[model samples]
Target chain A: MRYFFKTIHLIDYKNIVPKTVIGLFIILILLIPVFTRNVVTLSTLIMTGIWAVAAMGFTLVLRTGQFSLGQSAFMALGGYASAILTAQMGLPFWPSFLVSGLVSGLIALLVGMVVLRVGGIYFSIITLALGEIVRIIALQWEPLTRGSRGIIASAPPPIILGGHELVNFNASLAPYFYFMICLVAVTGLVFWRIGESRLGRTFAGTALNPVLAEHQGIYLMKYRVIAFTVAGVFTGYAGALYTHFLQVITPMVFGLWQSIQIMIMSIVGGIGSLVGGPIVGSILLYNLGEYLSRLDTPGLQSFLFGSVVVIVVMFLPQGAGLVNLWERFWNKVVWREEEYEPDEPED
Target chain B: MPPAEILIEGLTQSCIYMTMAFGMVLVFSILGILNWTHGQLFMLGAFIVFYSTTAAGIPFPIGILLAGLVMAGIGILIKKFIIDRIKGELYIGVATLALIFALEGAASLLFTSDDRGLAIILPGVLNLGVVAISYQKMAVIIFTLIVMTAMYFVLNHTKVGLAIRAVAQQPVAASLYGISTERLSLIVMGIGCALAAMAGAIMAPLYPINPFIGRTPMIMALLAIVIGGLGSLTGAIVGGLILGFLHSVIAYYISYLSEVVLFGLIILILLVRPQGLFGASAK
Candidate 1:
């Protein structure tokens, strides 16, 4: 009976409420398509999801103690790869999408292997330079990338199940919205799992203190490269999805600003819970941006975004972003958690 | 195989990059963070110079000086309010980056996004035997030389220079020796920004002045500092010259491919010597 009761309790007291809330929130998100078919609303949600994935990737790289300023380069690589394969080479969309991610991952692995050897501010500068190089290549390589003119990508073909037209991309934004949800779910699941695993702890070790982690038998470069390559793969997928959704692939699509945007999202979202933080951060910021852009006030978006970041950093400090507010609310109010105190001495 | 004109142009480019890089290196050595908004500060300086000289009818030299002083004041305010409160290196860098968008946005809204010029400040060309360079370009070069010499004198000889160097090298030790790191940081930040502004103000005539004009110079300065070695002043100058000459000569030959080649070269150099040419080994 005790065992049964314990089993019913499931896990620690801390996780139960947050987990349940998150699960219910996800279900609510999944039902969003049914409730709203507004193009602006759906597209905003889709873009938010894409940015979230990218932000998650940025946070992952940060977890390994390396600041990657050029993550958007991988996105460009993926977008260009998928665009070339599908639009130019007449390859199927699904296969091209997977291939794009692989190609991006391969490039990332190679770059990480070489650059992670330096592994500090130098690595960051190299990544920044790398983003520029990729953009330049995309711009100059007209034969491959269609130069600055950009390439038009077609929508994914409709899904046919048992001789009935099921999900159609051409019909409405619903399919794209659902697709984005699935991608975010899968990416978030994988990232959350990694965070729960021993690998996450090792990553923390390296990030907290590299020298101590190294002395403890952790190969710093290997772990750093692993985190980077993983991030590259997902960021590539996000890029491919973004390209296909926009129905265009151009050198101007991804650049230094986008890279910085991803960084901002990660930082503002709070790096505490990789999955939750990015999703929340990107959603809020992307919506804010969309609204600000609609106002068409010159520089307002930039100014507001900058001000938000400054305010967050000033108030939160560390990596404690907006998500920290949620955690604080839970601990301070809902849970009524007390400060650490030792039990009275019984002896 | 580039002509003397390109060489002179490269020299002018080198001067701008060198000044920018020197400021960045100085800031990095003292503040322990990369000021990502340094580029926007440069743009602000150019605008100050442009408006002062053209609209306010200030003389060119006075305009440049005004730009420097105004930028220095702005820099001090930023350091005091934003940077000082930030704890970690990463957050501080991001905070400065935030300043970039804010500054750029403010500049765009205030100035409108049109391209402006200051070429009227120095109109005529001075013809040398091998190459005829514009007077504005010549002035840029001469002004840079004077600034560099003056900076060298101040840094090497002045008591304040000793204190600044002391703080940069060992902040805790400097504090023990009755030097205030807080004061030094503010001064360094001021001077660093002033240098960037002056460089921008001087170059306003040579290039189109827009809110976005600061981007390329910022990138070039960053590259120069990295190539020269991050914390080394001399390295910044050498790197600036190398990058400037390489940029002009190569662009003259192959046009846009120079950037790719330049990045490739930087990566190769980093692969071999990670700390840069003059940078100290990683701790």
Candidate 2:
């Protein structure tokens, strides 16, 4: 079995076929609304896409070895900023979205400067506290956020093409679904590019060994802050998208639970594998939670989610989604051939 | 808003925080991982006490004892099975977090999400001139003192305590010197969990017990330990007292916005002293 797997591994499919396959998969996803106009399915897919974006952001920070339990704070900032800009200030959706990402990123940069200095568990605790503080602020700032009652009837995203209003997101799910798909694809592509860049290598180096990276002339603090800010931007974008889609903004929506859910998604998807891991994890876990909840079990969803996490961490440290266990299985059962050797060793 | 009332309330609150911080510090010192389920363990303790006393017809003191013992067993099991297998700070953190979710889910399933309370173990109030203090609050403070003293004694005088301390200080060295580090870990985890359970059981009568009630106290405990210095027992106690006082005094003055003020203070403190008020500089 091992010999067969080695032979299979030797035959590397290093071509554009894999890229084409992914492109085709994305195309199919874009066409889902056309095949079946089920509002529920569309809503779930939209949420999965949004969460996938946030999870990718989380993965970026994880790349720098910083566990931020305050991603929700950035999400809240983006959602609120965009909601306020669009609904109260009468700004266009495009500008509001851009400003939202910028706002979140800037805040993250500032916060990262201070908290990143206190690295490790201290960083995690501080971020957790920061998240809580943001939630509290949202709850207490009644004039701005309307407190726990939240901002109702928030402005929906307007689809505009070449200076003409094409569609209002509130009218139907198709435009919003396509918009989220495009957003997710763009976000994924951006992350993939980053992963293949020198900056991405720096992030990996920092995460793997900060001391070594620092010795090699990489400023750990700078890279850490950059990763955090980038993550904030992505999460903020997702939050803004979420607010516009739901047409409601509440402090409760961006609480610790949401942050934990995003973390769980990232972990389940395989935090090590930046793009596909988190996206797949989010879609599967979100759907699983929703499905379990519908079974009339009060806490079954959380219970099962927790169990999966525990089992994965304990048995499959690389993460269940990230590990290519199926390939090994296929090699063991189906491809039971001897290892190919162009030049056999004398020994 | 009398100073006396605030002081009394603060001290009472400190008792719970101290227990929590103490347990958290113990586990953290030995295992080097923050048990995210610490709060959930506290919640489980409260539920255990509630059920044992209210449903099973056990006496309140017996119920508390039972809760502690049960939680200690759970702690051992978690250590043996889940925590022991997980490696690295990040993975352990995630695993413990998963434990929190699972424990909370299980508690919710067993007890339902409704708020519950135990009958006051010590009823009536003592009218001391201008300040009246309830016997229940007095019991809470007294119980906390007793636990702390006992723990101090065990840690200082007992052979097991010496082994625990030795292992905590230098696990490899202690293991070479015939101390079983693995066994010590299990003991420490059990003791830590038992302490959390005790805190929960004792506080059940004072506050409405729910599956989620542990979260706030847990956060407060986390803050207390952070302020007190992560691995220092003395720091945990002092930090707990400071936080307890701040909580009572701030809540009295600021009402619901006290949480914001507390977290903000933590941020400021971290900025000023990243090592915490009593913690050693990071190694």
Candidate 3:
């Protein structure tokens, strides 16, 4: 079986089973809407997807060796932009949605240009402050954001195929689920490409040793800005989708806590694989949070969340997250790979 | 010109920020990772003081001291078990961040989330022509001054302080010189947390206490440290004072718009001086 697995080359796999399994897993997820359209299940999955995108963005920024503590601020910016454009100004949902991501990306670009110049704990502190600033703005800017009362966002209009409604968002969540799947897929694909490309290598260089990378003629700020901006764009999209799904945009929705949540999701998921880590981490943590939230306990969710993170960090130690465990299992149990060490000669 | 009342409020704000910022910067210099639970620790400190003073009938001063000692013990445990074991700065940060939720959650569960006011520790007012400051506020200021002085003396004049400064400057060399970085870290963590607890305990009487009250002050302290320059004790003080006064003056004129303006100022400051006002250039 090992020999057979080694013989097949789907993408550069010494072991092909994991790849095939991952492909099958994606197919199965795509087929979830067909199997069951249960509201509870679909909404949970939708939220997981939204959070996954946000987590992926966070992981991408982390790739460049910069900790972004205000990721939710971008989410808020995106949500508010889309919410105001659609609900207040009466713009079409689809166009406003696109604009939301762009608006978020633009802000990230501007902020990144200024802050990425420093690129350290300073960046982290500034971003944290940015989250609070965005929240305060959303709260005080009553005419636009409707203050703390929140702005209600309408769901996407139904898709018409040959004069018949194909997917009506308001009628069922299946459409929304499919939409979420597409968003995650697109984001995953782009992130995966980035990770596989030279840009990703440059990001690794910057992260591992800034001085060495700079000496190698890599403009650290440029790559940092790029990673931050790209993450911002997708985070914005995720935020916009989340607002439309929830049908409301409130200042209370995204702030320091949400940003921390995104950071936790990304870290717990493992930063090993850009796309896979975030999806796995967000799905696991988000589902866990949802379950805990339903228990009617005040602090159980937080306590459990903290405990889990603490445990993961203690065990994982490095950048190895939950995905690392899966890899270890495959290598040790399934592959039965033996350790390679040269024998030492004793006198 | 800002009124004297605003200046007094700023002073009160600055004292809290200075204590919190000072402790945080000290910890960061030694631990090399910001204790994300610093705020939660502050909250716990307030809870501890409130219970001891009100329920246990402990004297107010003694209650504050108890809060500090307990928090120091907690901080030491966190450093030894959780922080010390975690390798890498990023992971340590995430670990501490998780602790925030855990600590906050535990606090909420144990104390409940309802607002509980600390019985007035000092019940009087210092009436000046321009403004009359409450005794509680005055206590906060005086307590902060005493703490700051004690810290300055310790950091500058003591053997342990010398070890701490050496470790912060050169960890490897300091370790080689027989100064146990591990032991020093534990002490620093204890001191940092105690300072945070003291700040919380001191401020307890002035505001309604809850498990979540640590959030705002934490952010303010964080901003203070950033502005003053991370890892610089004097910078933390200066930064705290500037932020407090700036916050009050801005809020007074523009109300809630102060938050935006404060953040804007941070960005501006960073653009001009990335290392902060007192921070040395990054290596």
Best by lDDT: 3
DockQ of each: 0.46, 0.45, 0.57
lDDT of 2: 0.82
Q: A92-163, model 1: which lDDT tens digit per residue?
A: 999999999899989999999999998777888889999999999999988888899998988888999999
Give lDDT: candidate 3, residue A232. 96
Tell how far residue A1 is off in model 3, in angstroms: 43
What TM-score does each prediction get for chain A alone? Answer: 0.92, 0.87, 0.92
C-alpha TM-score for every candidate: 0.95, 0.92, 0.95
- How far is each candidate from the true structure, as Cα RMSD in Å? 5.5, 4.8, 5.1
lDDT per model vs. reference: 0.85, 0.82, 0.88
Worst 10 residues of 1 chain B by lDDT: B86-95
Query: Which residue pairs come into collision in candidate 2?
Result: none
Worst 10 residues of 3 chain B by lDDT: B84-93
Write one digit per residue (lDDT tens) for candidate 2, span B243-271: 99988899888898898898888878878
How big is the positional error of residue B48 in model 2, measured in Å on the Cα after superposition? 1.4
DockQ of 2: 0.45
- What lDDT tens digits, residue by residue, belong to model 1 across residues B2-35? 7999999999999999999999998988988788
